[model samples]
Target: MSTIPTATRRRVLEALGVGTAALAGCASAPGAKEQATEAETTPQEPAMNAAQQTDVDRIAADPTAIPDPIDRSEPKTVSVEMTTKEQVAEIEPGVTYTYMTFGDQIPGPMIRVRRGDTVELTITNEEGNSMPHNIDLHAVRGPGGGAEASMVTPGQTKTFRFKATYPGAFIYHCAVPNLDMHISSGMFGMILVEPKEGLPEVDHEFYFGQHELYTTGDTGEKGHHDFDMEAMAAEEPTYVLMNGEKYAITPDRHGSPSMSVGDTARVYFVTGGPNLDSSFHPIGSVWDEVWQQGSIAGPPNKYVQTTPVKPGSCAIATLHAEVPGPIKLVDHALSRVARKGTMAIINREGAANPDVFEPEA
Candidate 1:
């Protein structure tokens, strides 16, 4: 797969004013001073110690970690457990940020259940965390989407029951007063309510979450960065990431999802953007089928190049791996991929299909 050259990426960053010293004069931006005033009153994550800073964990959720498709015909009660964690993790090499998450990963774990099934979800706020948290699932029909009943303070656990009355992919996120801050910090994920008949079978299925992070420092700065409320209010993100980190799902980072040529793969993508929308696209390939807006109830659109996934929404798309190479998953808003670090990869390995794609020899 082709990518923007390093020099071009640097120029793009410079043009966007996201350089290493970008935030130095941000105080002069319009309304920035007022946003800074508001930020001073916002609760902030505590600073990490030397060990916490050095021993940071990867916040990127594994794309391959998702529940199997439901096969049973009858709907049953399903129990889901999630723990809220505040962790200091690297967004890129040398740049660490504290992420507030569900189940210790960005876009938390994917919750899968059949439509009409009763879901009993329990959320536990880790005792060591500094802030309170709660879950607001779009699949839930009650007030606050279960957020009101599931608010948990440190060391507390709360449970709420809801029937999965609909068949669609939904976003779940923290519903605190500073929700945007929490979500931008990684407190979100997807819940898939499969139709009773079940979804189309594919050789491989992957889960991914997209979110933007607003930090006080410049992009790629070496240090533990703090959340930038002013930047978030301006919708100017330091990084537009997939799975919590810069290109976290690529071969160079945590490792890309793999599939064999000729195999079919379905991707469940959730956009937890507290601000921006995504022009979700797969480079080097087209979506063979797309469940627009994650609505599996309707017929899928065919052979689309890209689909828009709004914040707090989800989309499901399938791809046919016809050639042997890497297919890139990007926002299609090229600057984000080139400068802000948003990308994932699906590596297909097998004999090249010249009929499908033949590069100049």
Candidate 2:
């Protein structure tokens, strides 16, 4: 197989009538150094037989897995290890994307620790992978947020220590150079550094990370497609999705969980945008309590309609489900939902509150 030079790749993509702004937003053109790194880290193992494999449906992590609020009287050392692997998963019906992930799951797995706890973090890039990867944690107050120390090539592992000095839901994502492409390819998740007192308990808690895919083909296009560099550069994603799929969290799709009426839902949301920002809002509901920027240290604001979850950031939003219906989770940009595929649904069970909102004949 031959590698296309960055210039040639851009030209070919442009001639094919790809998005016009595609090349404009690129931080810089890929150079010889990047090419050399790619060559050096190429995988050597036999490729998996695609026909023999099956796509695992979306799986939600149990909220109980997250540690309860910490008792500050005893601050201890916590250890965490995450692995990086390349996977092929469905991003939409009949469409798949190659995702570089932590723990082999899109949006990765959530890392939770208490403020003031010393964290021993490890990142391992599996041998079957073909590139180097690292992590940048917003909760860490250090150089590159541990990115510089955790860069590991395929079959290698690196460890870094960081003190959790802040209390917030921070994003942790791949920070190797050209990370935009890596992140858009699905290498991102959230880390929660809980305040010593912890957050207010809710009836149900859900975790989601929002990100976009720049594909070589249009939205909903069938068949496996290559990464669209031009689309990424232009911030024109073919699909913008939550938890890594179209309608991933809807009751009708893949058995994702739904909230019951009168149940208070606390959503741990992270935006892993390598380029775009997220205006997160739940349709037909208001945020009863919102921790801006996922800040647990500060008091939450009430009645937030929508909160901006910028690139590489997070927010904690709580909604009290009073109505019985499908609560649409969307980015208010609307275009992303109308064209791209940014959406999730929380079905409310139990009796309807027709007094508050009733459909008339």
Candidate 3:
């Protein structure tokens, strides 16, 4: 009943120290799909016009750019401001998508605060936006995940305060009425509520987000893509991407975010899934330590092969780069990798540790 070959499955199970079939796509559920229509696929004017297209193109010209690193220090009242807007973005070369974003980036900015710190959060919907938006943070302990209190109309701003009582990696996303459509267009990010003791130091840390796009055009189709509400409602996405593009975090694309082979990397991962769950896995590497669902309140799960990050949630995983090669990160939904854009590369640089793993020509 396993989709993986027997030999490969054995090796993976051995490496992971578990025999569960969770990583084999046995727990996946169907998602909504866009109903195919001539106008949907070939819209004369995409979500963005010529001028707006030019503006976004300039903003994302550097695809591999990462969010600024956070300073994890003493507990203080951290004032954070987030702006919401929509723009046309490149899904990949020759492919475009309309992304409704936070801070004008696909996965918005990363917010960090200590467990007991007070967060003065501000949400602003730009004047040009056509719809209302609000944030629902998983870390919040109030009504609608704080969604009800922060709803902002176009050109309006809302402010609220919340105390970070627990420690964990949490997801923050739009909770508008048509939630699926809004998220699929890219309105989500991660907020780290660090434990008072803080996390173990790592040589490298990188933050990224994964979300699905339900486009009118098929995967890899040329030209501008339109958002399909029908597909989003059904939870069927045409592209499942990391950092908003086809491997946008890799050296071959944006020429940044590479790790030295000897360095231990901490990955802050969040899924903006209005529907699908992510079976987070890194091919050719084991999770030496992982904070399941980003919960720092408990002990970490060691030697984990894959962990599911549900929609509107987050997880923290650490990988030791012992070998020199591309540590391929994926959702473990093989079809999504084979078809949709759900892949990232952590290029390792160092001497080969043949004892750990080696190849023969």
Write candidate 3's Cα lDDT for 1-361 as tens digits.
4354333355468778765665434335342123334435774433322222524652222323434444566678989999998777688777776688888876778888888898999999999988999999988998988899899999999999998888899999999878878887789888888888877878888777889988766678777777766667777788998878876766666654667887998888888987899999999888888888888899999989998988888889999888888888899998888789788777788898888887872
lDDT of 2 at 316: 92
- Candidate 3 structure lDDT: 0.79
> Clashing residue pairs in candidate 1, if any?
none
Question: Model 2 over residues 1-361: C-alpha lDDT tens digits?
Answer: 7766443465578779775576444435668567657767996432221221224544223322344545565678999999988877777666766777888676788888888899999889999899999999988888999999999999999998989987899999999988999998888988988878777778887888889888766677676656888778878788888877776766556545577888998888888898889999989888999998888776899999999999989999998989888778899999998887777777788897788888883
- Candidate 2 or 3, higher TM-score? 2
**lDDT, candidates in the order shown:** 0.90, 0.80, 0.79
Per-candidate clash tally? 0, 0, 7
The reply for model 1, stretches above 4 Å from the true place, is 1-56
Error of 1 at 281 (Å): 0.6
Tens digits of per-residue lDDT for model 1 on 136-159? 999999999999999999999988
- How far does residue 98 in candidate 2 sit from its true spot (Å)? 1.1
Find the number of clashing residue pairs for candidate 1. 0
Ranking of predictions according to TM-score: 1, 2, 3
lDDT-based ranking: 1, 2, 3
Q: Looking at candidate 1, what is the lDDT of residue 269?
A: 96
Candidate with more favorable, higher lDDT: 2 or 3: 2
